[model samples]
Target chain A: MQQIKKDFPIFKRTINGKPLVYLDNASTTQKPIVMLKVLENFYFTSNANIHRGIYTLSEEATDKYEAVRKKAAKFIGARTEEEIIFTKNTTEAINCVRVSWGEKNIKKGDEIVVSSLEHHANLVPWQELAKSKQAALKIIPLTNDYTLDAEAYKKLLSPKTKLVCLTVESNVTGTIVPVKQMTALAHAVGAKVMIDGAQSVGHIPTDVHNLNCDFFAFSAHKMLGPTGVGVLYVKQSLMEEMAPFMYGGEMVESVKATSATYRSGPWKFEAGTPNIAGVIAFGAAIDYLSNIGFKKIMAHEQELLAYAKKMLAKYPQVKIFSPSQKHAGGIISFAISGVHPHDIATIFNNEGIAIRSGLHCAEPLMNYLGVYGTARMSFYIYNTKKDIDTAEKALKKVLKTFKL
Target chain B: MDIYTETILDHYQHPHHTGALNDATVSATEHNPLCGDVIKLDLKIKNNVVEKIGFVGNGCAISQASISLLCDAVEGKKISSLKKLKPKDIYDLLGVTISPGRIKCALLGLSALQKALKLTKN
Candidate 1:
């Protein structure tokens, strides 16, 4: 197994005079040294605008910028480089799809399907689209164990359904959704499918082609890369059908007094100067993940999750929220009987252990689970069983201190 | 990382004046759906003054404890005077600067208080 801890410099620092045990990977993964170096090198050496400049520096910068697009294409198994459009983050990527595809295709009486497991980023855009287009927004309910009811989802789909947007892995429940099956069902109904891969991409292997999704969106920061860079993958055939979300320089073919011709899909969607350094660092993140091998990373996280669940089970006051014994992703969400999640998190913080407290961006799921909030501990390759042990110890101390 | 103060934790561990007031003239509930923090405030008013205050609901320790602190702060004060309380004032009482993300948690109690005060006027 790779020594995942060695790649991150932040782990070397002390928190509260103790070694930091970061369990907030679900919010944002810590950057690897490789990605940090790539960003530094870009600023120190090749910092210039792309596509419009005639200087050697601009050519080099453009080459590197476009190279990252190719890497992104390969990473998500996009058939062509033109299918990948870069944005500020996953929220921007999803908004682009809503504005472009949703605006043109969805009409009054049409329906868009979403699940309760969505982050606000996914839910709000669709709600706005539905309101503007006079379309209906349908939601798939979760099972008692917090898994999406696929059977219920099938019943929700109909000829009126224009699109289906779902998460690949839930940020709160940590449930690995059946994206392939869901995509197939949506496609069978002639409705397009968009997968939110924000929690899946680098944590697991993602192939857009194999998943047969119409669009896939993920952020670089959640995958050990820099922030402000995200990828949107549209299938080659669907790219032509989707309208441009933004129109500006570098995306026009020609201009006349009356009309202006726009460039093809991806470039046409990216409006202004992009986050060049963030994109270059994203490629470095991909390289680091590829070198370590995603399979090993998955295995390590699975082991950690199992150990965490087992250890947390010993706490009678604790209530775990995800489906039992499933190979869910690294997140573990639970609530203590008498202790509020914020209290648990604060006590853990004093111990130099970091965890997330709240709805984890899935407010609907929290409502369905009938809880105020939960304390979430998410793992990555750098996290180990020892980290889980530390979290458990800290949690026990909190429970006892609270006299729960 | 010290987003929560020691007093906040103490209040969380041992909440003060937590319950419901059956004879309350005003009552209201406020929730932060983003974090699933909920607080219900009940106040008994006499001659336009808050005679007693109570709260009951589920929330993070910060919110529950803050509500507990709020109960103590506004128990005998005039409703008009207590309505002027701001989130920063509450944070100052706790002696800590909360994270931007957690400001809602601290504000949950104050929001409930305001709503309950409005209810009493009605």
Candidate 2:
């Protein structure tokens, strides 16, 4: 934990004249020094466009860019590097799948199954696809505890289901959806599966092959990597079947006045000059995580979450949203009685403790919970139990301050 | 806890003119679902002047206290005058420059008051 804290230089700084205790990992994790330095080194040395020139700098840039792809492929346990395609973020990655796969495959009368506990990025693209394709967008309801009922999910799946797009971990509730089981079920129904791994990738160890999802989407920023970079892992066989979403310079093999030939699979998906520095920095982030061991990171987070739950449970004013499931990831969402989440967050901010308060880009889940929003504290390796202790103390003071 | 200024905290802890005003001609409820801040404002107007102003709700100290302060500031004032009250007035009264996000919480009460005034004028 001490070593982990050292990696984040911003953690040493102060906010509002007080020591910073950042708990907004669910929004975006702080980049480690290794990731930051990797970015700096790229700009300082190999500052050139990738895959275009035979110059040494360009060759170096291209190698670094493709190397990150290999790292990202291994990071998510993709079967091959060709399955990975870079995009702006998870939002874009999901959009790529919606445009590339849904545009071609989804027809009128087909269905796309998604869970109620999805971020707007995961939900909106599919809704737009359903709208354009005249397909049915079926949402599997969440149980009272915020878990997706497998029975309800099974009932939602049918031969008419063209795709099942869902999040692996809900950003709002921290509920880990049974993605592997759901993927298997979707496959059985002959529907493609796309798991939104935006909130899951660095939070937990993910194996795409083991899960057997047709595609997985996630952002680098959520995993202590640079922003403006994300990965969309398409199954090799499925990649061959899907059409390209975008067309332009980097992706095309040849262009004529009337027609154009495009590159295959991942290259075809990447249409323009990508975020080279961000992708390179992402490789550094992967290395940092690999060094720490994802298992150790997961264990640390689980311990923190357990401790946080136990500490917060003492406050009767506090209402926890996520179920007390062992499989739930390291996010805690709760509402303090008599105090609005914004108020709680405001008070915490004054104390130099950052937390996310609102629907967390998951309005459907917020509606299902019957709460307007919640104050969410998400844990990463850099976070300590002491930080949660400070948050708890601050929360108690906030409750008393509000006369709750 | 210091998110609310000392003045605002005082008002929150001992809210003035809080609770429903019976026989009130105007009432409105405003909510910031993002924060779970709910304010139920009750106002009585006579001859275009606010005869009484009161509020009841569940919220943070900033929100509740801001409403209490709003009640004190708006009572006996013209409903038309209250309609022009901006969030900055509340922030100035609190004597703190709130973060952009918390400005909404600080202003939730004023927004409710404005809504009530709008209904009363109608």
DockQ of each: 0.60, 0.42
lDDT of the candidates, in the order given: 0.87, 0.87
lDDT of 2 at B94: 76
Scored by TM against the true chain B, the candidates give 0.91, 0.91
Residue B104 in candidate 2 has what lDDT? 73
lDDT of 2 by residue, A172-234 (tens): 889999899899999999999989999999978999989999989999999989989989999
Over the stretch A327-356, how does candidate 1's per-residue lDDT look in tens digits?
389888999887778778878887889999
Model 2 collision count? 0
Candidate 1: the clashing residue pairs are none
Q: Which docking class does model 1 fall in?
A: medium
Off by over 4 Å in 2: B5-86, B108-122
TM-score of each: 0.92, 0.89
Candidate 2 clashing pairs, residues 3+ apart or interchain: none
Show model 1 residue runs off by greater than 4 Å. A257-259, B1-29, B79-104, B111-122
